[model samples]
Target: MPHITPCLWFDDQAEEAAQFYVSIFEDARIGAVSHYAEAGQDIHGKPPGSVMTVSFELAGQPFLALNGGPAFRFNQAVSFQVVCESQQEIDTYWEKLSAGGDDAAQQCGWLKDRFGLSWQVVPAELSDLLGGPEPARAQRVMAALLLMKKLDLDALRQAHAGG
Candidate 1:
């Protein structure tokens, strides 16, 4: 299968965003960086030799960050999910990614990062807890989840147990 890479459009912050992401993910690294040339100044309007694109990898997944100007912005409709094995992992990621982020956008383990990117920090067993065989228990878990910003594994388990 052909390798697919998600390209992120930024308003002249592609390099900055790529660096920030590389700092956050342990298995991340910045790859090649391309600069704008005078040839496309009429269309792109970016200064010659300015950063135009940055290639990066996060957790082994390849990505591209483009300095596409302010024609677009990130929204909650598209989000990156981080499945953590423990509460500590979730806490670490949540704290790091949510720093300088929009507090008003935080809900149910979902947050808008400083760069306006959406992220979901969730437990690894979230699917099992929210889609268990018992519909009532799953509903309870869902209720507990909706009431929380950062998910509590213990509370979810308790809700599933009908506590």
Candidate 2:
């Protein structure tokens, strides 16, 4: 089967971003690093032999990071969702991803990483708790979730249970 990979554009940090992502996810690894050749230095305006792209995988998902210059940037319009099984998982991702990011951007489990990449570190049970059979309980969970920056699984569970 064919696969489609999401390509991320960065100013000059494709390799750094790829390495950082690999360190965060257990099943991730840096696959390849390609450098710019002398031919396109005029049009691309990049130094010859500089990093051009990086191939990597995060938790089994393939991604490509390109040192495509500052023509584009990452914004909240796009985000990667990390479905966490436990609160510890959420905490880990939240702390690491938000380390050098904009603190004002954190809300409802959504955060922007140092690279300006947006991420959603949410509890795996979040969907079930907010879309379960009980409408009132789910509503409560939604309300609780809206008030949090980093999701609190325990608080969500209590809200789901009408506590």
TM-score of each: 0.97, 0.98
Model 2 gets an lDDT of 0.95
- How close to the true structure is residue 48 of candidate 1, measured as C-alpha lDDT? 96
User: What's the distance in Å from true for residue 149, model 2?
Assistant: 0.3
Give the alpha-carbon lDDT of every model: 0.94, 0.95
Q: Which stretches of candidate 1 lie over 4 Å from their true place?
A: none
The residue-level lDDT of candidate 2 at 64 comes to 100
- lDDT for position 155 in model 2: 97
| lDDT by residue (tens digit), candidate 2, 1-163 | 9998999999999999999999999999999899999997889999999999999999889999999999999999999999999999999999998999999999999999999999999999888999967899999999999999999999999999999
Model 2: weakest 10-residue lDDT segment is 125-134
Cα deviation at 39, candidate 2, in Å, is: 1.2
lDDT of 1 by residue, 1-163 (tens): 9999999999999999999989999999999999999997999999999999999999999999999999999999899999999998999999989999999999999999999999999999989988856899999999999999877888988998899
Tell me the deviation in Å of residue 40 in model 1. 0.9
